[model samples]
Target: MMKDLQNKTIGVFFGGQNPEHEISIITGEFVIAELRKMGLKVIAVYIDKNGIWYSNKKISELKFFQKDYAKKLENLSSCYLDLTLSRNKLVLHCNKFLSRKKIDIDFVFPTFHGLYGEDGTIQGLTEFFHVPYAGCGVYASSVSIDKGLTKKLLSSLNIPTTDFIISYRHEFTSNDDSLIFKIKRKLTFPVFVKPARAGSSIGITKVKNADELKVALALAFHYDTKIIVENSVENIVDLTCAVLSDGSKIVTSDVQESVFGSSDLFDYSMKYLEDGGAQTGNAESNLIIPANISNKHTEKIKEYSKHIFKEIDASGTIRVDFLLNKKTGELYANEINTLPGTLYHHLWEKTGYQINEVLEKMLLQGYARWRESKEIHKDFKTDVLNNANQLKLQHHSE
Candidate 1:
């Protein structure tokens, strides 16, 4: 599969009209570098904050996203996938000369983090064109991206997740007192309020009492219409395990425990801004690989991670986070990240797979999934269309 990929052109898509756009760009750059190291041809596709797409070799450079990025975009061509083209040929149309406008791509590696890119929108676009892309498909992507939906699905599957109450912007606005009453009645204080669809902890607040509940909900609603208020695990340790597949066997990476700094929660600044940020490779210090937990907890985390991965019908790679209550020794599934930052290659690395190996496996799994989907009979024999006139005549006679 790796050898076959060398002969094909892979498009690395990153950035978007998302809060996690910068993080996605970093992931794209990392993946592109790894693919290129394996001698694969890579096309860097950058989606600006305004949701416009551009393709250029310079996009792979970090400097292109820095100062005066607008002027730099003038040198690049804005591109879009021409879905009207044949399935065998995925053509990326760009605003350039006719000869240079169409770029053929055999596969896609989406490095998007949140919102439109990670929440099944881009996955649906690729599925519409019948193009092979990395990470989970539409269903899994859609389910995993929304916190409220993800929790509901997991609860139905008998998976243990932190107790959460979902609130909508309209409902909260119309009856703020009712919503607040429900939260006060159902859950205890010191709850975590989060935007249902946002990632990278962009719009999250830790509410300690009723006085802070309304403010937290308002902040969350600023990012997304729906918000989830989950009961806080007082003595909790954040553990994450990544799951990956090579289209045959599934494996889980080593569990890593997140060590938070002065922040009450692992907010946006802690994730991307502290210690020179994730792009500079210094933020890794906050995560402890082979987390200082009992072997039982580690195995259970791995088991839950794999189970959730299969249950969601996810392909490629994913990371499942858990909140382990230190006092009770209970673990609650936090959320599933279909497209984890940098694909969580760091976890896989500790689990004995190189970054290149992880990329190869992801690409191979995506290709195999696409091939399997092609085998299903899409053209079902139906006479309804042909007999429409006869049916109409019969109805008129009756």
Candidate 2:
């Protein structure tokens, strides 16, 4: 039935200049692996940190990520898509000197994460290119990627989220002490400070007192211009809920609880360094089946999740993170990961769908969005372009 994707030259586009660059690579590689498993012909396209694009042979090798990757990558030829011209087709202009070799891409599966990629930039480019892409459109991606914007939109919809002190970089650096006092006065200590636009908890810090506030601010501002510090959720337990869509409808996966080590919060080391389970290294989460929570709680979270999805007009698959106050059992939407890890395939795996199946569904959604977008048109046989004399006279008069 889905024969259109068979050897369709799908572009598995990932990698870029973001703090989440490495993580994006992991996700992109995993998505490509799954796509290949479905027997789909994928043209792996990578956007390097310097903004150079690579494709074909250079993309398949995982070792291109080694310490001297750029030097190694310099040899394997480069490619780029010229959307500056008419983007009605997937023709890629290799290089000016070389004969233009147009890549006949069926669709683009953007597995990019963090700033420049997730913050509506890449999505906007795709829209201009008129290319089919996985996940939300430009509006959803922009609103949902920016934490301040997302919070305002969600709050307007009555979505429950933590009360936060959203601070901008320029203002905070001027008066850190006064700002800290304001936070201390308004909200209690043990707050969570994070860069507004990051994921995987890269620039997130748990500050318990005034002493730790400065350090946390410095760490967070390194990643973003704006920072948000949420009043501590007494007994923070994270609940991650994922939703998959094929544009027409959404199917949710089971809620999973992330249990932390008793000693401290799940720092980067605890989350990723743990090599073996129950060991000091190799980050692993002890996933509790069904979350060991009441059905009522599950239903509340699931309902709220779907509501947020529809309200934002988000499509494709998204993972909405929530933090549950251990005492109150309240679920506060932490943030929305627009392009979540491995598209949150692990969550679906627990729900009976394999990686290949999930990838297939996402591709279908991509193509569906593409087909639907064809209904809109900004083009027309305008008399202005046809009558060059009229346009020239209008410009001169203005």
Candidate number with greatest lDDT:
1
Candidate 1, position 194, lDDT: 96
Q: Candidate 1 lDDT, tens digit per residue, 1-398?
A: 66767788898989999788889988889898888888899988889998888888788887778788888887777887676773754687888766457788888889998988898988887777788888899999999999999999889988899889998999889999899999999999889999999998888999999999888999999999999999998777988999999879999999988888566777677677888554223588887888999999999999999999999999889999899989999889999999988887767888899998888888999988888888988898888887679777889999
lDDT for each residue of candidate 2 in 1-398, tens digit (9 for 90 to 100): 26866757777778888877876777788788877777878777888888888876656656667467778777766787765663744666565354656676657788888887877787787777787777777787877887777777768878788888788898788998888888888877788898888866789898888999999999999999898888767777768788877767777889877777573455554444455321111223555545777788788878878887887777788778777887888878868877886676667877877777777777788787778789977778767656579777889999
TM-scores, all candidates, are: 0.94, 0.88
Please list the C-alpha lDDT of all candidates, in the order they appear: 0.86, 0.76
For candidate 2, the per-residue lDDT at 346 reads: 65
Which of the numbered candidates is closest to the native, going by highest TM-score?
Answer: 1
TM-score of 2: 0.88
- Give the clash total for candidate 2: 8
